[model samples]
Target: MTDFSVLAQTAKAWPFELARALEKRVAEQVKAGERTAEAPVIFETGYGPSGLPHIGTFGEVVRTTMVRHAFEVLTAGKYATRLICVSDDMDGMRKVPDTVPNPKSLEQYLQMPLTVVPDPFGTHTSYGAHMNSRLCAFLDQFGFKYEFLSATDCYKSGRFDAMLRRAAEKYQAIMDVMLPTLGEERRATYSPFLPISPSTGRVLYVPMKHVDAAKGEVTFTDEDGRDVTLPVTGGAVKMQWKPDFGMRWAALGVDFEMFGKDHQANAPVYSKIARILGHRPPEQYVYELFLDEKGEKISKTKGNGISVEQWLAYAPDESLALYQFQKPRVAKKLHFDVIPKAVDEYLTFLEKFPKEEPAAQIENPVWHIHSGAPPAADVPVSFALLMNLVAVANPTDTSQLWGFIQRYAPGTTPATHPLLDELAGYAMRYYRDFVLPAKTYRAPTEHERGAMAELSARLKTFDDAPTSDNLQTLTFSVGTDHGFENLRDWFKALYEVLLGQSQGPRFGSFAALYGQSETAALIDEALARG
Candidate 1:
């Protein structure tokens, strides 16, 4: 077998930092015979099924998958890697989300397992299954490789029986780790097992009346005033948050798991519970919360922040993939405003990857984003530039973009330039939604008009084809000679008069991209209006 471990040790890639740390920790466990060397490295992501999947859910899985791919590269595919997406569908529904219609109906089903509650939309058998399918659909849209596991199925199939019994045996220790985090009243009645009410069919949070550790059973009184006894090991019970998290890690032998920073305080408690239950907790990754534009954490149930559909509407999947590929610890604002930049950034990285040395290419963000198989061709056009072109040219169809694209990068076709085609589609949508309504073109100042006229005259002097540099120099000279204080103000005037935006891509690149004749005609039209 190829020894990629040595290669992993020497690589300076950003992903290797996390991959090596995990590998080293696991390697120590192997050396001590705590784990077998051939054991598959499992990367797991948790999802809450109380509501539809949001952008944050997409982020967690995409980010975890990126790390999984990096780990695979580090192991040279010698060690097996599996990404498991586990949904906490068995958890009781605490509140009905606003996104669901007629939420009043949900009050009756409160405290019931999400898997058992009727899907408000009536699209599926239950709310949990619908939400889980939504999560799966989002991942499918990105063509991500993963295994979907449901908490409800795991319980019903008896896969969690052993862990349930272990929790009952270590009940007091689990309570000791969790109780201090709760209020005095909650601490007095808290039990790890939430037995399913025999009458109401709801998961009951009421205090456990009796526990038999040896029998793996818990007894509780139903709301109907009758005693209920059931084995906690079967489908009759589910553990609370901390204990459940720990139990899953131990039972599944997960190698890595990630959660939001909001769970940072709870991580140690879960780790302790895992250790007490005879397994060490998986390697933990705590990511900062996805905050709104106001800098508040975006709540999943509020249906706040950009939705997965919303981001995918204006941008491609790779753009969002790049957004999630950044450092997990750094908090990022998720909003529509972030899409264009992220899209351009992804394209920029794609454009640069082929030119870098093998060592640097391996470390490139695009490498990890594309799972070491980045696209070979570099489409020189940027999403922002394309958006501006759409604003200026007002293409009736996507084919119009080909004219401008081929001017700079010849022989580029929709067939050959798939990303640019997709980007053009995004640009049109973005221009219509964000750019068109806000457009307010200013009539150029007389001085600005004169400068533009000079630019028009200078462009006419170019006998040969105009280069971006030459066009840039001419545009710069017009501004400098016409008493503009700096090129910043000059470009500002150009964008305001021409594109009706305060900022844009390099004007020279834009001029060359739009073709000299069309650019000259644009200046003439602006000068006429002035």
Candidate 2:
């Protein structure tokens, strides 16, 4: 086995950097005698089941898993690790998600804990359970290994009882940490503890009339104006979001956690509250939010971003993983158009992995993505090439595409190259859905027409199979010989005329894959149409 500890110490990849930091943290904790075998290093990702899990959710868990894998490599299996996925199901439903069925039905349940609200789809016990199930299903589909923790279960089952009492004991201090951040009106009404109404079963946001820290209870007026005193433990009350953030960290002793940039401003409050509760806050990573095509932040309610399911329909999950792996701190546009490049880039990295030295391999995203044992890349053709093949061949099924694939890569079959066969299917679907509708064939200009005619005549003269290199050279010479100052213009003209798109795969490789005589015929057909 290759030893990655030396490489991991200096590897500049984001995961390795994070792993090293976490390793340092563990070392310090061990030195202080705070770490033990019973308490494993905990990596956490939070999910709000306000809506179905989106690509952003997938990105967080997958990225955290990458860091966890790196930490394992750095530690050389000396310490245990656990990945916990926490769902805040105890949160009150503020509004109905527009995407959910029966939106109006959910309005009556607003202000109630999500665990108490009726499932809009009628699939689970409550809306929160339904959404949580969807989240687990989504993650399971990708084969993620994690322990799912529900806030409702934690609070009701007495797991958080001690922390709840601790919060009650520190209510004034917690309030002091939060009150200044809110406006005067909100501050007046806000208490760290949000009591659940005994009569209505709603999570009440009313102010605490009195906090008895010794008794671990708070007195508050219910919505009906009835004064009531409730114990803070045993699901009788829950902390407001900001306080809850810190309390969860302290209660769980989470070693590391990551959240989106939206929560960055509140980090200090979380950390301070955690310290007040006598626990150090977890190391936090704030990643930039994903944007839509318009550069607007992707919102689950608005449904502007491409979803995990949507991306998988047009590309492999490996491509989606690659998308999540690259430049995570940078805001990226998540849309259908980004799929092809991610697919091809994933292939490029997979092909490069075996040839890379151990030090270089440690830096490769695939190494971290696959936990250092990435499967051999079996696909011989690029996704871009496959998409172009779909464009020109207009194959009705994978078999037709495979025919051309077999010709280009001799002896290759669907059984032998399953990934490539899968790519062929994805390419066909992508072409039909995205490419076909947008394609616009235009007539070639007079000069361009003559150049294509010369190219076509030359291609017809090739008696033997033309190599990609020789064909590329022939096309380049033909472009320059036709008085085109920029070779890109010649290629652009070809794309417009033949593929009915502005951009395409490398012409020589594409031509070699789709036959030379067939390409010449395609040119003649384009000219005839013009």
Candidate 3:
């Protein structure tokens, strides 16, 4: 098997189950003498243009993409694959966004079929097109390679007519299912695909036929889990919904589709509609909802949600991709703190994995880290040290850091490499603690300058030794010269010279690691400046 195939098979535990089910379905169809081996298989996802697409929206694309990738690996180029991102742009404006400059009085018609939403930006012909275009660009930028299709364009084509006629003929069986599913259904039937207008905060009234048709006959109310219907000026099949689903399937030639769990009923509705349209219904599944960091379900109206733009602001796109690949059935709770950690973790994974043949990808974290701890073979140093290194990094040059790594880490590295950069970052914390906290011995007085001169001269003998013990020896020598005066005071002055501060970490030890020549030169410069 190819690398991609092996990695993919290991990653997908349920592939055999899915493959078996698919084979059985195909065999049954073949036995009926109705199936073909050359038919195109599609992975389709319809996006809503109501607002900026969120991470959850991207999750669908990622999962569907994985499925496509899996099948391609299985077929080894025998089956042609395509992932279609259908933008339901023709949908009407149901809720106005606060970002738009001026939202007209389009609410009454907003929740109607997506084909009717008005473009509030006045940028596109309709709201559906406007939202669809943005979503297409977003999906493309997200590394999803898919063809974009629009509902309005689909309706313009005659692809839906056959499906519609079939639905019209099988309309009674659909009603049989709908009446039982809805319970207490009365005078008229309903289609699951009709755009529902959530006017009056909840009621989904049937939209009037044509702006000129004058009056809508169907009135629907949710009673005890049933869609109770009553007589109105314009009710009947005109108020049904399958027409839209049937039309969409043919227009796009979609093979598989998935929706959120909230629409569990809609799938069956679409399936029956597909049968009525004389076409195969797209294979379907439901996605669970996402939660906040604290583990509560996300709601668009509640405004307690994280946007994709906010996530990408801090995360590399690949980390976001990993989160998407994480189990579709599992709900993830995420927060801001995850950003820095994700960056660190991603780098670690790359370091360990190092190679990617389509089949050998690291699809799960457990394979790397077992029982809450990473494998014992690859240990890492402290994050604090890395952060310190990064903070103190000089953009114009990095020879000094490279020299230190050669002395200590023993490897080729980037100047701004994550670990190195973090190590240098220590200087920032040092400044806050010492440079900003001095109250006495602020600068070297004349006598102190003489003492500093004497100390610097004596330190020349040990210029090559920056180790802690050597620094301690030099400190003892300097301590003997200031018997009556505060020996600590002179030491602070020395620190001011070396690190531009009155006090810092134990001077001798710090001077050693920072290098004897570098420390000596800094002391003289700070003395000259003040």
Candidate 4:
């Protein structure tokens, strides 16, 4: 029975820091009688459904959830909370995504609301519906507790009708906040509202001729040069993206939200517009964008970075969450190579959690990732070690790796250690996909060859039950005894000759798990091949 509130107060983890800020905001609002304690504190993450949801979208929701959980702990459940994942489905599609099928088919629908654009996949009624389905499925897979929202649905169902009317009344005041952020040309054509043309059915971005605040209608010239007057409510008109950002906040009474660093510059504009619309803007956390292997910003259209499916195929979702939790404000390279490290780091944190002090545990990421109660670290083997086992064993089935795993961690079975069993499967898939194709075995140098041969023979004399420390010491002696000046060359030689990779797991731990006799036979095979 740990006092989480005490721990949360001193916890330096980013989520706790954010939760404290939110707590303060809620307290002030309650004190001013602006909100009741029973009112749910809103946490929001916005998505653009022009393309399929990507890993960045996953990061935002997961990170926001972490803060939400922290807030729950800090407040001791005194204040209710809500997480809203909203998709900007009413936004017009500007261009076809490079990854989607039938790019030419979507060209005719340019500037139409995404909810109206035909889904090229032909699976859903519209492009926005198809994308929204994918986004919901993606979030649902992670078991996130949230309410899904559609911008189109919100506007059409009259949920945003009051906000739309408020925007109509304060149209000029909202424009004052946006006009300075744009160039002279953009400022001239830009109106807070984009009218949905009744004739073309496309969202008309043309400059407005007149706005009747009392009538909640706008007069805008359509593409055919005919002036049309449409009511602002009931989905007839939607605000531009910038104004929509602030208006959504004002409408939802969102207490907290987070977005990428790209939106940092416009945060003030959004806040100002929210103030003008008569609601306090949410506390915002702007995180750095994730980059691809070549250091370019990850784009959903480009499909350059590792995707959610790609990551889950090679690693557990926990590892992916751990990656999101760490250094969120700093840019990280999202690629296949980053998978192993993320997995191992997650394992390390889980292993440390139960043993850590309550204060220390609060700062640990696994606590926040699991909402304070992390499962026991049942996997005795590291992902890197399991990957090496797969590399060397080249097992066609998981049972083969399980055989080695059972030996290293005695009494462990696939049934007993399900996580380890899962890791074994993940490692096998990773080795087959990534490690096997790039494997290049280099013949050992003269000194290295003699050292390996000596080491192999010595391994035969040792008992099967020897400790990893004992085997590590034995390997060190063999390397030094063979006149190797740099010990790195010894391990490098072992990796190239034995593992077919330039770097690998600690040879001692790998051998202990992979069996000393089996490792000796592997060395003999490598030597014979050379």
Instruction: Specify the highest-TM-score model's number.
Output: 2
Ordered from best to worst lDDT, the candidate numbers read: 4, 2, 1, 3
* Residue range 1-530, candidate 4, lDDT tens digits: 88898788878999999999999999999999999999999999999998778888999999999999999999999999999999999998898887789799889899999999998899999999999999999999899999999999999999998989999999889878888888999988999999999998898887889999999999999888889999999999999988899999999899999999999998998899899989999999999998999999988667798999999999999999999999998899989999999999999999999899899999998998898889999778999999998888878999988888888888999989999889999999988899899999989888888999999999999965777778888899999999889998899999998888889888889889988999899999989988
TM-score on alpha carbons, each prediction: 0.95, 0.98, 0.61, 0.97
Model 4 scores worst on lDDT over the 10 consecutive residues at 463-472
Q: How should the candidates be ordered by TM-score, best one leading?
A: 2, 4, 1, 3
Off by over 4 Å in 2: 99-101
Tens digits of per-residue lDDT, candidate 1, 319-343, equal: 8888888766899998888999999
| The 10-residue segment with the lowest total lDDT in model 1 | 1-10
lDDT of 2 by residue, 22-122 (tens): 88888888888887645699999999998888888999999999999999988888789999999999999998878788799889899899999998788
C-alpha lDDT (0 to 100) for residue 360 of candidate 1: 68
Q: Rate the local accuracy (lDDT) of all candidates.
A: 0.85, 0.90, 0.53, 0.92
Q: Is candidate 3 or candidate 4 better by TM-score?
A: 4
Top candidate by lDDT: 4
Better model by lDDT, 2 or 3? 2
Q: How accurate is candidate 4 locally (lDDT)?
A: 0.92
Superposition TM-score, candidate 3 onto the true structure: 0.61
Model 1 ranges with Cα > 4 A deviation: 1-7, 12-14, 101-106
Off by over 4 Å in 3: 1-33, 105-118, 183-253, 276-281, 355-530
